[model samples]
Target: MSSSEVHLRSTIGGVSVEGQLHTLSVWFILALRLMMGLAFLQAGLSKLLGGEFNAAGYLANQPASNGSPLADLFVAMSEMPLFMEFVNVAVPWGQLCIGLGLLVGCLTRLAAFWGAFMMVLFYFGNWDVAHGYINGDFAYMLVFLSVAAFGAGRILGLDATIEQYDVGGQPLVERYPWTRYLLG
Candidate 1:
């Protein structure tokens, strides 16, 4: 272990994991970022490339159940003609943009934030109450949040390139602290 490592002993469902935080974090963050990136990319491509893709049908049929608190919101969204039109375009494009950003590890923090937002909408605003259980959306959302928190792009991503200073001795991130947050 390196001097930076913090030893940890933890268990999940009776399985024990003993390791150093600094050592594990690097691998975990990179894998998590890459996986989440691939997943978003696949989903975005499927939606964008799919024929006659529309959010209306999915939004319109939200089980409309009293058990589902978000059902009303879904209904309200569906009822708005302009909103539906916007959603039809926005969902696909937003997914595509977020996916591409994450995949290349460009604008990593922004990509992670948006990815988490979408998963929140999917897990809480659409799927949770009706489904009666947490699902992959929750897991994926956590992964995205982890990437942002760990600044995973610095591990092996374009963000690493953007992080270094230029000949002017000013990194782009010097112009925007937020870029440092993304590249970290």
Candidate 2:
């Protein structure tokens, strides 16, 4: 109810959810975006520059020790030479692209979606339930999802400008509503 707080309410599947956010909450949201961006960027760069980032041994071995349910699937993937080749390239490159997209706030939702997806696989792959089912991977997954849902890109990000770009005399988002899924 305070002037410095913003109220938010939504109804999903007939369930109403509501909350209040302090005006300064946007800064925290931006911080999450930047932090994840840096983490992923550094990871990708290290993998690409390491020149010995073979995933086969890790994929075939790590999951089993951790008792991951997908351990068998990972092992199978490692066995397939072609798939392993693709994985070697995709993992590092995907992280780099996702990092850049999030850092610059360009195609942020797309980046965040992929980031969340990668986290999902990592959550299963790492499969550490030592203290509990919750872990860093699971937390990162939520962070990615929250970034997408909050449209964090529009806050001091290129997405704000990209959305307002003129297209046939109309803002890009207004012209093509579907772009909302990718841009913000």
Candidate 3:
């Protein structure tokens, strides 16, 4: 590669070049990241502010006799009031951290992975509400999973710069194989 080409590649994440705008997929990924981050931020702030964020009450109100897998889990968890309190506090903070990480494009892959896990918890928690599909929770989960799979961070985030380094080009990344998808 020419010297100029090497410089360009090295600076990709540092600054946006005039003709090197991100692709449509990158833009879509950015939008999804922002939306998911905002959603989690709002939920976390509401909980922190004591704005009727009552998971226990909501779980208790669920129909225990309905034989829903989620409901059963909820009932079991509700039995431990202390555990519920911990969850109430932890859930909000976890969302806040994950949301902020995604928003700032810091640790994008890790954030997406955690976001997906959270979505799974949400999906199971609300399984009875939508019959296991066609819900915001499921949609969010899928989106996060996609981001994790694609490593969308490299498209326009700090990961793009990070990847230029030797560590980012390590065999682990090559073996994982998904990192290449993020290069776009």
The predicted structure with the larger TM-score, 2 or 3, is 2
How far in Å is the alpha carbon of 8 misplaced in model 1? Answer: 12
Question: So what's the TM-score on candidate 2?
Answer: 0.96
Model 3 residue 101 lDDT score:
68
In candidate 3, stretches whose alpha carbon ends up further than 4 angstroms from where it belongs are: 1-22, 51-53, 63-67, 128-132, 162-184
Comparing 1 and 3 on lDDT, the stronger one: 1
User: Can you write out model 2's per-residue Cα lDDT over 1-184, one digit (the tens) per residue?
Assistant: 9999999999999999999999899999999998898889998999999896788998899999899999999899999999999989988999999898889999999999999999999998899898999999999999999999999899888999999999999999999999999988
- Number of the top-ranking candidate, with TM-score as the measure: 2
Return the TM-score for each candidate structure: 0.81, 0.96, 0.68
Candidate 1 regions with alpha-carbon error over 4 angstroms: 4-20, 63-66, 125-133, 165-168
Candidate 3 lDDT by residue in tens digits, 86-144: 87877888888778767766677787877888888776666655455568878899998
Candidate 3 clashing pairs, residues 3+ apart or interchain: none
- Which number leads on lDDT? 2
Output the better candidate (2/3) by lDDT: 2
Clashing pairs in 2: none
